[model samples]
Target: MKTELVQCFVWGVPVYRQRFSLVASRPATERFYRLIRSAMAHAEQLRDPFTGDLECDETTFGGARKGKRGWGAAGKVIVFGIVKRNGVVKAQPIPAHDRASIMQVIQARSREGSLYYTDDWQAYATLKLRGDHVVIRKEKGRPVGRDHINGIEGFWSYAKNWLYPYRGVPRKHFHLYLGEICYRFNHRDRDIEPMLISLLKRLTVDDVDLN
Candidate 1:
């Protein structure tokens, strides 16, 4: 059951509750999804954080309905993210865009002495206290020379495009989806199939203990 479940998840040949639904109930499939999500989240968190050039940024997710867009729009989830210039990114749906909230992610995932970039948001003002902070003013058109927060911005675009298939993610499961996105982005260059399978197997020996 464990191997079968892991294969089903990695293949995506049949999405959640697709072929699994034929044999198991909806609740069973849901439980399996939750279990795998936990494994994925734990695996991603254990990775060594970035200590090199970093790009910080924020973006809102899930604004499909009609209403205002960006920041303060209804039914939107504000996500704070930091991406290393070369690759690996870490992101999560934050409570608010305030300094207190955004700083938590920065402090947890980044190390001091690293040079970085960000948009002209006041919340990231204190990043310089720990590392070299380079501010990129978005209103001033394209960045000159190598000045840009393009890495984080590119991550946002990649995350949104990857999430399109899910249609809409539930608020309760938003963190898992965001974590999955970060994991995918970090491992985008390599084949993540074996890593994902290894994580799943470690989390479950015989079958998922979803209790």
Candidate 2:
């Protein structure tokens, strides 16, 4: 992958174009993309910094729909993301924002002793009893303690402004889109070529799709 990408760079083709060329073989490509998807699926794990005493929260994805407010949401996907103070972040799409949905994500990603920070949402109120849930009022002012949810918020902001260039993605295929985003987020500091290489190493030809 590195060699091919370098070849593309020297030849003056876009990386995506190079990606297309690399996966020209159908059987190999299908397996390749599958590996990429798999890498994305387990991308998020609570960071060490946040795990010691963390601020956790959930938020919805997608932009405002033209005709209506919540109607626009129905078409958009919902995701829950958390950032530990140490700067590790993890995110996943959730089916809904109900208690069961939120709890499942929290338990899976968060450690038992971690400090959870969140807004005054009813779902997070239980954090106090279960662990150390600190509630804040987003409108009241800024939250206190290590209760800042800025990390996850920043992720959403990037997703909306930077990554949504394709616009109006179908809900059915949201996971693929998410996999790509998670890959990028997990490797934020790495260059595009290395980043692609890292992703490609774990994935097979099945993971990426140009068509």
Candidate 3:
């Protein structure tokens, strides 16, 4: 079976690809994705910004398995993401989208003095005390001034677009996918070489089996 591995930087996003006869090697794409993400999680970030016009939103993604709306979405995946005004995005898959879950993420990622923006989700009301919280209602539009949640909403659009092209992704490993998307969103304007090295620096020998 003819097999090949390709490495390409897609618009500053370093992508590693493997090609071979499915009849022989089959596909280990799942393992590859997990390895990449695991390596990323280890990389140290100089700053996990928790300030600025932080836009927060939640979305669902996964397979066509049997289930209810959000309920069926259970076991699927729920991703909560935050983006700053400058187009940097951070996303993670949460076990649930309840207040506790959302709060935990916010507390971990947000700074004390940074502003936060979101829709009228009650889960974010507590942020009003933590920092400047701006809530937009469906009937009402986003804030007119500098505080708007558009950046995060734009991230949602980008994420769904990329996922649709890949068809339905498996639920078991959705967080890695989310991390890749966020990495792209966060560094869309910069060269990916540095980003790739940064991610590699985070990896230990056990993160990926080169052999």
Candidate 4:
């Protein structure tokens, strides 16, 4: 790896690209991003199942558009997230926000008996059979009781804020970017330098060509 590539990792891709474009070519920058994407994809597979109080929710991602807004928006990506209270979060872009789609994520990421907190979405109604499902109806003001989906809702805000600076992400590659966000959130407390170095080592030894 070139010194500029290491600098790219240290300073972050956007900063390195703006300041050192003359030092590293565009292809090298893209390669580094691809490497990060590949490492994130790998880390996503190692998630442990959620077993405690979990929050589940779905949110739409996209910029301001001409037509519908919020859940009814068109041309936007729907993402479902399951977050263990005060723990890790797992999120993915789903094809739809239907029962089958949301249930698939819950079944895969959460344990059978874990307590689930969600809004009054029809899709999550089936979760009652599989777990202790708690529904909090959406209201004008803040929630009053112990029933709130704030954990997963916070993750959605965090992800959207982090992604906002990029303007917009391409739909086809959104999954990879989503994986990266989840990886970052999962490892939020760790020292990024060592974690990134370890990922780079795995990238090299795993014989996976990210190019």
RMSD of 1: 3.3
Query: What TM-score does candidate 4 get on C-alpha atoms?
Result: 0.88
Residue ranges of candidate 2 with Cα displaced over 4 Å: 1-38, 42-50, 66-68, 140-147, 202-211
TM-score of each: 0.84, 0.70, 0.75, 0.88
Every candidate's lDDT? 0.76, 0.60, 0.64, 0.78
lDDT of 2 at 72: 35
Backbone clash pairs for candidate 4 read none
Provide the global lDDT of candidate 3 against the true structure.
Answer: 0.64
lDDT value, residue 102 of candidate 4: 87
Give the lDDT of residue 190 in candidate 4: 75
- Residue 45's lDDT in candidate 3: 33
Off by over 4 Å in 3: 1-24, 28-30, 44-47, 63-67, 71-75, 140-147, 206-211
TM-score computed on alpha carbons, candidate 2: 0.70
- Candidates, ranked, TM-score: 4, 1, 3, 2
Location of the lowest summed lDDT over 10 successive residues in candidate 4: 8-17
Q: What is the per-residue lDDT of model 3 for residues 59-172, given as tens digits with 9 covering 90 to 100?
A: 777666676666345456777887777757777777787999888888887787777888888888899778888876654554655556778788888888776755665565
Q: Which candidate is the best by lDDT?
A: 4
lDDT of 2 by residue, 1-211 (tens): 5455433432334234345466345445444444444555444322332365565556666767666555235566777777666565667788887778877878777777777777777877667766777676665566666447676677777666544554455566566656656556666775655555565566544544433
Give residue 130's lDDT in candidate 1 (0 to 100): 92
Q: Is candidate 2 or candidate 3 better by lDDT?
A: 3
Clash count (model 1, backbone only):
0
